[model samples]
Each structure stands twice: as structure tokens, then as C-alpha cells.
Target chain A: MTDTDSTTTGPLGPDDITADSPFTLPGFFDALAEGRLVAARCTECDTQMLPPRPACYGCGSRAVTLSEQPRTGEVISYTSVNRPPSAFEHLAPITVAVVELDSSARLTGRVEASLEDVAIGDRVELRIDDPETVDIDPDFDLSYEEEWPAHVFELL
Target chain B: MSTAHLIAVGSSPLGKTDLPGRDLFSKALAEAFEELPDPADVVDGLYVGAQSERYENQIMQGTLMAEWAGLRNVPAERVEACAAAGALALKNAVRDVRAGVHDAVLACGVEKMTAGGTEGATNALGAAFERALEQRSGITAPATYALLARRYLHETDATERDLAKIAVKNHRNAADNPRAMFQQAVDIETAMDAPDVAPPLKLYDCAPVTDGAAAVVVANDEVAAELQRRSDAVRVAGIGSAANNLAVAERDLTFVEGANVAASTAYEDAGVDAADVDVAEVHDAFTVCEALLAEAAEFAPKGRGIETVEDPEDRSAGWTDVRINTSGGLKARGHPIGATGLLQAVEAYEQLTGRAGERQVADADTALLINEGGVADAHTVATVLTATDGGA
Candidate 1:
């Protein structure tokens, strides 16, 4: 469980929804940039949500706490985007996968490998990259999303 | 409680059209109001379903569509749930009519998807997925559904060839449909040899980007009787919808549980069972979806949905005799995103009233429609319609 003084854990009220709270996107990405992958672990039902939110989807509870996530997970499913959106056309045929992290919080991200190399159950580790390093078209990024980082997976 | 009746339905030609979004809506509106009285006399309110403003760079579609329909003011608004926006509009209209809020309401949907070309359409549709994770990873509509398709294949005895046959079947069905975007039948070899849009999903497996519109007029029983004969009307017997997990990874990979809930709810509300449905038009954005939805809607047994391509007698024992996607589904009839769900209703209207010319299913008195938006069942709307004279 997350024990950092900077992050608060437990059910949040309306007053606790500030940008600084890990329940918000800004705080979640901020932690990721600093090498801390945080998820909101629902205390009531144990649902782990990546990009920590205020409530749990599992049991619809707001009684969630901050939980630092493990980097390694297995690929739950995999596919390749042969004709991607305009912003990512530069990276056509990008192999992407739905990965369940070691803590059971699942998310989707690009896999750093060819489609042929990746398979379901392949062990992979999450790697955070600065948004600028990814070379996504600037036009695709909304003004508020310009500074956000992108996540990718590398086969272990 | 008032009974909601679908009095009339109409659609613009489905394909890459040379019309603006409003013009497409006008075409549908004109066709819908053709046999009925003017919109000013027949309807009290309007709901417009539109997926994105990116293509036309416009919002306020509710006001725009209302004005075009010559409706001055009576609760005009827009409803959206990505591709399921059309059915969402219809649901709201039915609610209004059933609750005595309006005697008649117009539910319409429009999309000019071809305006942006392939890349622009791709970018616009990309907004439907969970933005923070999936979008950043470069996922598109086909790609997200491909994720579902991949896991489905891994767990089932179904093969890639089985998926190809779904395309072939829909194409063959489309060949007989006058309103289909693709009117020609394709062989299994052609479907199998098509270029891959995403692994496990080929070009043929994906629905085309279409420019189209559909309009449905829902009214109370009194207004329906005033407008048309009882035999010509179809009853909105039941409605159900669900919003599942936005992120693809978080939800069940194969079951499409949300769709199941929606379908089951609609069946219960309609006082009918899956076996009683003579025809169905489901969301087939991808070939795998047809199979997935077959099971979700309880028309086929689990892991045996691929038998959708076979004859009813040839399917597994647990499967129902419901005819799936007789309008060629989204695969060939054309998926105009915002207009798709209403298009399904249009086909149902045709079948239930005995107007579906060549592709008609015999004694198709009861019909089901399942429209979904986002990755699989991130949002779903299931509706059951029965002919007024068919024992409803």
C-alpha cells in the first residue's frame, strides 16, 4: 500500500478533488513521471484502477486508497494497429497489448516489439517516456494534454 | 403509462455520399415525413444523435436538426454515446412518449464520416476509447475490437476462417439489400485474402466509413392510430442499455456481459424470450462482434456463436432460431456511426411491418436491435419491437 506522505489514501469527499490529489489525472501522471506508478486500490472490493480515480468500478465505492503498482505483468491480449489515427501514422503497424500488471491493475499501451514477437502471457515491464520523446503529432494533443507522458511496455 | 409506437422510419442512401450532415438529415426527415402529416403537425419534440463534431466541426446538432424539421420549440436536444448515439436518441424519444411528456417525437441521427477522409475519420473515431491509456497507445476502433477478437479466438474453438465466413454471409445478405453500401456478395476466399486492418480483423471484417442519416418517429398509441393503421405500426415493447468499462483491458474480453444485461432486460420488459425473436439486427462493427453479440443477446450458446453463419438447424442445440443481421448488419448495410442504431431500427421497422422487400424474413413479427459504442460494450442499447397486429 502507498505510505507516501505526499499522497492521501481513503475515501475522498468533494473537497479532496484538487489537482494535487492522486485521484486526478495530473497527480497520477506526476507520480508516473517521478518513477512511481500509482493505482487506486478500492479498500472495499480490492479493485485496482490505473490512472487512479476517485471511485472503484468493481463495487462502485469511493473508499479507495493509494497503492504503488508493480512494474511487471503478463500480456492479457495483443494486437497491431495497421492503420492508426493520423497523429500516430508515423508509427503504423504499432503492436499494442492489454497488460495486467503484477498487482492486477490492467491497462493498454504500446509494446516495444513486433507483432510476431508478442504473445498472450508474455511477461513485460512498463516504461514511462516523456511526451516529447514519443514524437506524436502536436495537433493530436489537446492544450491541456501537451505535457502528459506516454507509457509503453518492453518484454522482460 | 402510455404505450410508445414506432409509426414511421426513413433513412438516407447509405454510402460515401456527396451531402453535408444537415442535408443528409434533411433527406431522412423528408422520407420519414413523406406519408405522414408535416413535422409541425405530427411531432412535439426532437432528439438528434451525432458521434463527433470533428468531422463537420459543429455541435448544437439538436437545435440544427430541430429547425430543419420545422419544429419551433418543444424539448429539442442531442444525445450521444459515440456510435450508439442513434439508439440513445430513440430511447429518449420513447421515454418521452411513454411518460406522456409528448404525443410524438422525432429521433434522428446523422454523420458525414467521409468528409474527413480515412485519416480524419480515424482520428475522430479514436476519441471513443479510454483517452489516457488506450488513445495514447494509438488504438483505433478496429484495433480495440481486434483486442476482443484476439482473446475470443484464444479461448474458443473458432478459427480465423470462421470469422471470414461472417463477412461472406453479411455480404451475401447485402447483395439482396437495396440500401447496403456494398451490394455485391464476396466469396470466403476473398474475405480471407483481404488486407489486414488489424491482425485477426481484415478490411472486409470492418465496417466502412459511411455518410448517412436515419429518422424514426415514435408516438403514443393515440397519435399512432391517427397517423397510421394499427397493422402498419410497430410497438416499442421494451428497451435496455448499459455502460461498461471504458478501457478495453478492464472488461471481460469475450462475454460482452453488458450487452447480455441489456438484452436480457429488454427481453424481460417485452415479456418475450430470445426464442420468440424472429429477426435481429446487432452491432457488427467487426466480424467478431457478430459472434460476440450472438452469445450476448442469448441467440447462441457460449463459445458457439460462430455458428451464426450456418443455418438455424445446423447451429448448436442451445441456440435460438433468430435470424441475425438480415440487413447485412454494419458490415454491408453501412455503419454511419451516429446513424447506425436508427438504421437497425429502420430495418426492424421494415421487417415487422412486412415491407422488407427481398431480404424479408418470413413471419418476422418480433425483432431485436443491439447497438453499441466504444470498445465492445462500453455502451450498449438493446431494443425489442413487435408488430402491433402480431399478438403484442
Candidate 2:
């Protein structure tokens, strides 16, 4: 239940501990490579962390486990970006969605659904990003979209 | 507690210009100083609220801003709080004067967005939101605000027509403002039918990419008395600032919580209610903001800010006495990001001093300026300003 011991593959010393210790973005990608979705879940209040953070946004609890994320969520909001910035100029008219996962954590990802099929409260499920399709756009520069803009949700 | 007053104000034109950011700031400042009798000798400190360094291709801009403005060796500080950067500078200036650190301070906010064009401006502007969550999604400010606008429509039984009312009204108001960036007034049809930037939001619904600078001299009692003979000063009665959770979803999507908190703080500090406000400059970054912030500031009861737009004179119901965005707000006054907050201050000063000409409200005694950063989330800086004396 302690954050110190919850990491699955981290090799930490007795005093060494970190939030991204075992759960880096690459690690999230690793899990996705294995067809699984994982996020930090607080051991105390059960607040789920997406794009995981070191300190818990709720209750400031650091004792959390990088557990399997909920497969499904509901669309909370969406915007169809017709005129994206220079980094995303090629991907104009893309629909981005903010989804609340069943685990109660929220993250933004592209919704692989038609504007007609998707809505504010529509159900969605996490879909892994395709390595072949994800071009590492250096211009976005440390943006979550740079890392996971293609990591998306499917209408369910 | 000691009080601070806005003794002088100045602004560069709010529109596309070839001037560099520093020159715009200098011009605005030069105009501000021109209003004062003792100019540089009176300023003990300076705060510059400039925008994204990416646009200007410069860093550590305060010294350069002072140098460009011909300011000689005054203690200077740079303040940046996204779109509220200017307001933050003003807030710090007021605090400095009230704390007896400086007798007179200059707060300047300047931004040159047109230099980079629309995409460049969009990228720089997008940095105002949470980087980890919102920015990476390839969302522009219009797209982000449109999300709120859409949700607002669903929740409030309001339509695009209601939002258009803001665009129409602000434009109408700005038509009388000579310094406003957009002087042409638009009807509801013009607003609703303007080319789409983001659906449910159109070109007219959003603020234009403006290049401008605004500056104000905030001074204590002694300096105010000295400057009183030179210009009409407005009392900085109360100022309030608050921040909402960075994650927009964590707060109510329908209302701007930061604005509500900041407005309440300003109201409490000023010892006045919504009834006392004669004129207001709400941050109308987008049309939805006009509605959301007016309600958040409690100028209109819940779900009723639309009435302030739909019918400006129909204050018979719960819609209060305040006429919001008397300066056309960001929508028409022009939004130069960091400069916007100080621009609101400039506008409020104009309205209260009876110098606003056609844009002037009759006998405006008290005014409020609500400036915000982020898309419905993040910092809201609200300042309550009262005229030194009742105006004609």
C-alpha cells in the first residue's frame, strides 16, 4: 500500500523513492506496449492520477500504486481544433476530448469518434497509441500531446 | 491601511502595428509620463507586465523595457501571470505603495502579438493553460473557450444568440472608444455568422490578435495629492485576487470560480456590493467569458448575465446596476495578453473620470475591473476603483 514499495519494476534503495520512479511516460508506453492501461491510485483516499503526479492532487498522499487504469470513461468535454498551432498544423480539424475514466482520473486524448457519435457525456474507452503513427514532434516540447496526442479514446 | 490611487494612465493604440513590443511599451509609458508634472523623479519603483518572451525573442525584458522607455535607474520588477500579468503588476504596485515601500510606482503591461501572426500568437497564448493537460491537446484559446461555451449552452438553456449578444454589445460599446482596436459594431447576425474559429464560437466571439501597451501610475496619499492638480485620480478602494484549480474540470464548468472568489474579495475589501458598481470591465476574452464572468462577479444572478447583453436597459429584474465592459472589454478593446489587465485599469480610469467621451457612463462613481488568465481556470484579479470625487 506504501508508494515506496508499490512500484512493480523499480530498483530503489532503502531511502530512495520517487513518483515517476517506476512509472515514467516510457513506462506507461511500456504498459501500453503490453496492451494495458495503468495509472497511480492513492492508497489512502483512492484518488486516481492520470499523466501521474508525484504528489497526490487530493489529500497530498504520496502512498499510491501504479495500478491498472479503468478501461472505460465518459466524455466530459470536447473541442474540434480547426486551427491548431504550428506544431499541429498538419492535424487540423482534429477532435480532442476530455474524458473522466471510471477510476475517477481525467486526462485529455483524441476521441476516435465522429462528432455526431461523441458528446459531452458519451462513454469511451482507452485505446493505445500506435507507435507507427506517433511521430515524435520535437516542437510540442515536453507536452503530453507530444508524448500521447495519438493515445486516444474510442466511442463505446 | 494606506490606500493607493491611479493618478495617471496611458495606452498605445490597440491594433496591428509595426512597432516592436518594447517601443509599444515605451510609447505607452511616454504618454503616461507626459500626464505627470514630475515624471521620472516621482517613481520609486516600476513593474512591467510583458507577454510571452517567445513573441519578442527576448528574455529578462524588464531592464530593456526600462531602457527603451528612457527610465533612469529605477528599481524594476517583471511580473507575469499569463493574461493577468498586467493586473498582477498593478496588484504588486498597489501593495508596494500601501506597504510604504514606494511613494509612487509605475505598472506597465505590453504585448505585441501580431508580430508572430495568428499561429504564432495562438501557440504563445495557449501557454496560459495547464501545460500537462490542456496545451498538448493541440487546442487553441478559441477551441478551449468553445468547449466551455458548448457546455454552457447545454446547461443554461442559452443559445448561440445569447453569446452573440456579448459580441454585439462590446462592439457597439467600442464603436465610441477611439483607442479601441475594433471600432465597427456588429449585430447579432454579424456575430453568429462570422467565420468559425471554433464551432459554437466564431471570429467575432473571440478577441482579436492585438498589439498594445497600457500603463498606470499608482501612488500613495502624498504623491496622489501632488498629482491631483495635474490629473483626476481614482482611489484603489479594494483589490482581490484568487486562483481556481488548474484543472478546469475540477471546478464548475458553467461558472468561473476564480472570478467569483476574486470578485467577492474585491467587493469585501471595497466595502461595496454589486449595487455600488456603476461601470465594469469584465475580461471578455471570449463571448462565453463575458457571460460567465458577469455572473461570477455577481453583477447578474445565476444564469442571467445574458440579460445584461440581451437587454442592457432591462435591469428591472435581478440584473444589477453595473454596465459591464464599458471599454468593449477584450472582445473589442483588443487583447494583448499581458497588457489586457492594465488596459482594463486604463478603461476603468477613463470611465470614472468622465473623460471617456461617448463611451462614458453618466455619473460613474465606482467601477470594477475583473481580469482573468487561463480558460475559465487560473488567476482572476479584480480591482475596485472609485473616483476621487463624484464626476459630472
Candidate 3:
């Protein structure tokens, strides 16, 4: 077996990860795996944060709890990286986009399609893909849902 | 809202100065204090603006500057916001004096970027971006501005020649500035054909990483009246600041919203329009930044800033009307981040006082200074300065 193959596990098991390692999929990833996106809601300010931080950037309150988030979102803006860093060498010419979650929380991720199909206001859905094979893994992949087919723009 | 007057303006030689930011600051402070008619008088407060503490490893910079400048007992605070650190520090000093808390204060900005290598300094600047989203994506300041330059060219009629003309004009202006980092002139062709640092941004299009410091002493109207009896004084009419998202992807790439907001607020406070500005020292960290800022600040109409720079009629003799970056700006003046904002203020002080020998705008009455801390879309500060002896 090759080194690449050795690193590419079918699915990460609980024993293969740790809390300190960013690669260890956090609790949010567990929810994402179940098709339920999660965010953190501050108890004091009712502010929702996706890919949740330990404290609220808005009100600076640590009293926050995990809550379910809308899996659908609209693309706020995006850019195409013709050249990427070493770790993402395999992912050059990729389109990265900022998506405003249906709940109004913003998060960024790699859009898994041609750049032409993506644009501001394009609808996107959170989907899971094996992180081991991608150049820069975000623990999950993003793809357009079937219902928003007309909104997609094809990359030239 | 409060009245603050510039009593003294001085700088350590700005170039490839071998001294660190602290040392450069000390030299400039010594000169400023010596220039004061009463050098022994105690200052009520001190403010210093620095962009990065990661390289300097010196947190609590205000205390450090006060100690080094021999003002141990004075209350000192460091104001940081990327390149606009010094401008914001001056604004804070103005606020303190206006509130009747302090009558006299010293504001200084210093940056020692050369102590670290090029890559180290570049990475330190990248810290201003969103760590997880933008910085991690390999988007440095140059690349971010390059993306904007591309978009501006596509949406508007700007070309590489238009951008190069800004560099040529600033370089010629710098030739007359004795303290400018680059005092040599270059043709438009030389600027346009320089090596590419990032796509659409040539070597001449970017400011060099520099080490320098600038200081200005601010006082209230009473103190200003006293200073006028002794020497020339420049009065601060208005100050404004605005903050935007750290990530470039979050906003429109072609325009700077923070600059527009800050300029509008300052103009409103000064009760003057863009047409009234006799001279302006704007942030030109990149060539395109100056053009976009001119339009966004209403100094020129949208997409017409390029024409303003390129048109010979707009830059005729004895005209100097609406002069932008007369001191070469950060593009050729050297951008020692922390000191950049203060340097711009110093340029205005010199222009208004007729002390800027060769580069002086004839009979200047009102001047504006705009300083930005991060990339075009980040933190920005704008201030208006008027000659105390001159009229509206």
C-alpha cells in the first residue's frame, strides 16, 4: 500500500482522533454526519454562531449552548484560487465561497463544483465527503441541492 | 469635537534606517522635544501607534515609549489598528484634550519591520486577516489587492498604464521630499514594466517595508495660542474612524467602504467638502488603493480618479489643486506601518506651515490626511488639518 492510501482511512473512528487535533472532527462534525448542522447560541444575547466558538464574539458571553442550524444557505461571496498553497496543491483552481446560513450565521467552505456554476446568492447544501482524500479538508463537502439547479452558473 | 493644535512635528530620517522602531521613535521624540521652546515642560499624556506586537514582542508599547522618551510619570497608551495606528493615536489625543482632561499631549507612531526578514514581516501583516478563513487560504495583502486591481480593471476602464501613472507622479513628487524613502523619479514605462509581485501589481506598485518613526505634539487652543507666539502651528479641525470586516471576501472588492465612511464623517465635522481640500496625503500602500480611495472619498468621481492623475491639465504649474500623495505616500515614502499615519499628519503639518520646502503646495489653507491600517477593506482613519494663520 502507498503512503497516500495508508493515510486515507474509510471513516475516522473515535480512537483515531483527539480533542487537540483540529482534524479530529468536533461535536459539530458528529451532528453534520447525521445531516443535522449545529451552531452555538449565546444564552445572553441570542446570537447564533456557526462552526461555533467557545464564546460569543458579539456579547463576549461564554454561556452558550449547541443548537441545530438550517442546512441550507445562500452564497454571499466567493473567489477562485488559481494557485493554492502546498497542502492544497492538489486543489488548485478551486472555488471557495462564503455562505450565509439560513439562520443568518456565516461560514466558509470549498464549493465542490465548477466556478461558473457558483455566484452570489446561489443556494448550497451541506454534504459530507471523506476528508482524507481532499487537499484541504473541512470535515465535510458542500454541493448544490437538486431543487436549486436553476441558480447554478457553470464555470467557463 | 474638541480643538487640538499641532505644536511640533518632526521625524527621524525615513529610509533604510538601521535603528529599530523604539530607537527611531526615541530619535524623533528627542528632536520634537528639542524643537519645543520649553523642552523641560511636562506632557499630560502620551500615545503611540504600532501595527504588530508579534514581531516587536513588546506589548504595552505606550508604557515602553514613555519610558524610553524619558516621560516616565506620564500616562501613556498605545493605539493599534494596522497602518492607521498613528492617525488613531492623534485622534485619541484630540479627544482627551477636547474633554478637558489634558491640555498638552504627545502622539508618536513607530514601526521597526526590518529587524524581521521579509517573510516574517509579511506573515506578521497577514495576522490582520481572519486567521482560519483568509490567512489560512494563502491570501496576503498583495494578493488581496491584486484581486481588487483585476476586478477594477474589468469593471471600469482602468489599465496598467493608469496605475503606472500614479507611481510616476508620486515618485516625481517624492524627489522633492528630502525625507522620502525613495527620492528618485521613474518614468511611467519603468513603473508599468517592473517585476510582478502579485498579478497586476508590479514592484513599483507596492510600498517597501521600512523602519522609521514620526511624532507630533498636540495641544489645546490655549496652548496653541502660546505656541503661535513662538512658532507656526497647525490646527486639527476634524477626525473620524471606521471599521470593516477583516476578510476581503466579505465585502465588495473594488471599493473601500471604510474609507468612504471615515472621509464623510471627517468632512462633516470639518464642515467642508472634498473641493475645499487643498492637499491630501492618502494611503497608497498599493497603487490602486489611491485611485479607489479618491473616488470613494469623493475627491474624484467614480472611475475618473485615473484620469485625474493622468490629465496634464489637472496637474499644471502653480495649480497643485487637490494634490494627492505629494510626499510620495507609502508607495515611495516607505511604510513603517506604525509611523505611517503620523507621517501623513506630519506632511500636512509641513504643507500648511510652508516648511515642506520643495514639495510645498503654494498658499495651502486646508489639508486632509487619510490612513488605512489593513487591506483596503479594513480599519481606516481620516483627519482634516487647517493652517491656524490661514483662512478658509
Candidate 4:
């Protein structure tokens, strides 16, 4: 019952959920730019939220901290986007996965692997959205240079 | 402890049409006022639901519909929560009556999805998602729910066949409805053979892009006592609404937590349980929706919700046996966004009064409706309706 390791930012966070923004897929880009996958963890109940959150999904607490996530996760479910939206027309036939992390929380990211190789329980490691393999939507015309995150996963 | 009473229910044909949004809304409103007791029962308030204001190029729809539908200069407002807009609009009007603010109120909704092409409508609807994950990643409505459908089968051992059964059942039910878009019954074989829109979700598995309107008139208990046509009114027993984090990945995919909260609140307010719901009109934009919502409404247990919907080949154990979606649901009856909620109200009124033709649930005493906004984009409104004489 000695739960006083609240200040440590390594896995178990010490910041409040409200103090810093939860990484909504759009908001997560800042951290991703620095090569980190962070999640918002409830400071009070120790619940973690991937794609970050304003409140804890486990205990409904607003006292959450944005903490870095483990690099590994298991595939929960996946689909091949044979027909993608117009924004991603160039990236048609992308592979998507709902990856549940070993540490805490689940997130959806594109999986770069053979469709036959990926299974429900297969493990995958986080990979950055590299331009070589990653095809981004055309944002050539815009007032603001928007960064649409395309976080990917490599089959373990 | 008095609840609002539904004095009249009205809807027009549910299908693709060239009618302007105002005209569609007015048509349903006019149909609703057909049996008004008297001019003295003036509509003092108007609430309209339209999911995509941009689609119609019309804003201030509540005011416009109120004027075009024959009532002008009354308090009016428009509400939107994607597919749940109509349900919420009805709830707002019901609340107006409940709050003792107006003797009678009109709640209505309309959507003209066909006016815009399929791509245009899809984009308009996509405005309802959490832009961060869903839109940014190219996940559309059907695809989003497909995630749930995929996860449901994963957890429950249910098959795509189970989902097909729901589509078949709804199509069968819609065949009896003249106002329904697709009145011809769809067989399980046809549903199974339809092209997949998203993996695990066939084209038949999704509610089509429809255009229609529906309206309901509600009055306070005191106003109900004086109405000329009060004999057939159904009491608005209870209403509950709640939402979850808009992030789809973080939430429990198997369970619709928001519907659970909303339905629980509505049940408590209505002083009834799942057993008391003789019929239910749920927001089944996709087949998986009907499965998840059945569980949220407590029509079935956590793991067994899909079992409530029988195999398409077997009618004995189908959802109709339990009287769910006796109106064919969003699947076959058609889903016209804002109008769908009031369409549920219309169906519930018809069944409760024993006026439903072929799709009627025999001796239906109470009804439950679950109208949802977007794919768990965080809003759910649950309403329970009953015959005036049925409950305390």
C-alpha cells in the first residue's frame, strides 16, 4: 500500500492529467516528433490512456499525467483499408491495427507487415512515420502546415 | 412526477428525395398536426434536429421549420449530435412540456443526404468524428463501427453470419412499412453476398444514405387532459443521456458505455426494467450497433447480446421474437439521420396504440429507444415511452 512513487516519470507518472494536455492523435505529434509515444495516466488511480485523455478512463479522474509508453504492444484487431478516404487516397490498401500495450492502454496505428503475417495476438514494435515507407496525405495547399500523424508498427 | 404525453406522431416516406430540407421538415410537421385537437392547442415551442446544416445550405432550421410548418414566432432551436440529433430534439421538446414551459411543443427532424452525392454526404457526416484519430487516419463511419464489429466477434465468438441475421430481420420488418425506403425484404443470402464497405461490414450491413423527415407533438399531463385526441397518447416515461471520451481506441469497444448509462438513467426515471420494454427502437446504423445496443439496453447479457438476434434461417429465435426493431431499424426502414429519432417515436406510438400494421409487437405496453451520435463520438440519448394508462 506504499504508493509514493508519484514523481517518477519513467512509466509511472507524477503529473496531473489536467496540468498537461492528453495526446489526442493530433496532440501526440509534438511528442512523436521527439521519438516518444506518450499516454496520459491518471495520477490518482494509475490508469493510463493511449491517444491520451482529459480524464482517466479507469476511475474517471481528471488528475492525470502524460507519460511515455512502452515500445511494444500486441495486436488486438486489424483491417486492411482497401477503400480509404479521399484524404488518404494515395495510401489506399493500408494496414491498420488496434495495438494493446503491455504496460497499459491501447492505441490504433498502421502496421507495416504482410497481411498474412499479422494475427490477432501477434506482437509489434512502434516505428516512426518514415517518408520512405510512409505515404502521407497531400497537404501542399494550406494556410497552416498540418502534421497528420502516421505512426506505424513493425511486426515483432 | 408527471411526464410528457405524445399526442401525435407523424412521418413521411423514408427515402432519397429532391425535397429541400425545409419542405421535408414541413411535410412531416404538417402530417403530425393532422389530428390536432384545436387551434387553441397552439404549438408554443419548436425543436428541430438536423445533423448537417451545411448539407442543406440552411441554418436556423428550427426557426425556419417552425415558420414553414405553419407555426411562427415561437421559441425555437436546432440541435445536432449526428445520428442522435432527432432523439435529442424530441427529448428537448419533451423536456419543454415537462418543465411546464409550454402546453404543447413540436419536435421534428429532417435530413437530405441524397441532395449531396455519396462522397459529399460522407464528408458531412465525417464532421462528427474526433478529427485527431478518425478523420486524420481515413476511418469513416462504417469503418469505425467495423472496428466494433470486429472486436465484438473477437470477444463473443459471434460470426459475420450473426450480423447478417440482423440485416435480414430488419429488411423483413421493413417490408411491412410503406414509408420505409426499402420495402422489399432482403434475404440473408443477399446480405452475405453484398460487397464489403469495410472489412466485416458489407454494404447491406450499413444504413443507406437516406432523406426523410419525422415529427412528434407532446403536451404536459394537464394539457393532455384537455386535448380532443388524448385517448391514443403515450406517456414519455423517462429519458436519459450520457457520453464517454470521444477517443474510440481508449474506450471499451465491446460495450457501448454511454448507452448503458443513458438507458440505465431512462429505466430508473421510467420505473421500469428491461423486462418491461415490450419493444425497442435502437440506433442501428450498422448491424454491430444493434448487437451492442441490445446489450446496453439490457435486452441481453454482456456476452450473449448477439445470441438475441437469431440466425437468418431461423425465425424462432430472431430479435423479432423479443420484439426488438419491429419497425425494421435503421438497416431496412432507412436511416435519415436527424429524422430517425422521431421515426422511432412514431413507430413506438404506433405499436403502443396497436395501430402498427404488420410489424406490430402484440400487446406492446412499453418501449425503449437508443439514439446515438456518431460512432461513440460521446453522446447517447435513451428514451422510454409507454401507453398513458400503463405505468404509474
Each model: TM-score of chain B?
0.99, 0.96, 0.95, 0.94
lDDT of 4 at B73: 66
**Which candidate leads the pack in DockQ?**
1
Better of 1 and 3 by lDDT: 1
Q: lDDT at B208 for candidate 4?
A: 90
True contacts kept of 3: 0.05
Q: Model 3 over residues A1-156: C-alpha lDDT tens digits?
A: 011112312133556345432222354454454555556666677676655556665667766655667667777655565444434546666566656667766665666776667766778875554344343433212331111111111222
List the candidates ranked by DockQ, beginning with the highest: 1, 2, 4, 3
Task: Write down the C-alpha DockQ for each prediction.
Answer: 0.89, 0.51, 0.10, 0.40
TM-score for each prediction?
0.98, 0.91, 0.77, 0.90
For TM-score, candidate 2 versus 4, the one ahead is 2
Model 1 lDDT tens row, B182-246: 99999999988989889989998899999999999999989998999888899999999999999
iRMSD computed for candidate 2: 2.1
Per lDDT, the best of the predicted structures is: 1
Ordered list by lDDT, greatest first: 1, 2, 4, 3
- Mark the regions of model 1 whose C-alpha exceeds 4 Å error after superposition: A1-7
Residue B138, candidate 1: alpha-carbon lDDT: 95
Least accurate 10 contiguous residues by lDDT in model 3 chain A: A144-153
Looking at model 4, the pairs that clash are A16-A64, A17-A64
List the candidate 4 regions with Cα displacement exceeding 4 Å.
A1-27, A113-117, A130-145, B37-41, B311-321, B389-392
Task: Supply the TM-score of chain A against the true chain A for every candidate structure.
Answer: 0.94, 0.75, 0.65, 0.74
* CAPRI-style quality class for the chain A–B interface of candidate 2: medium
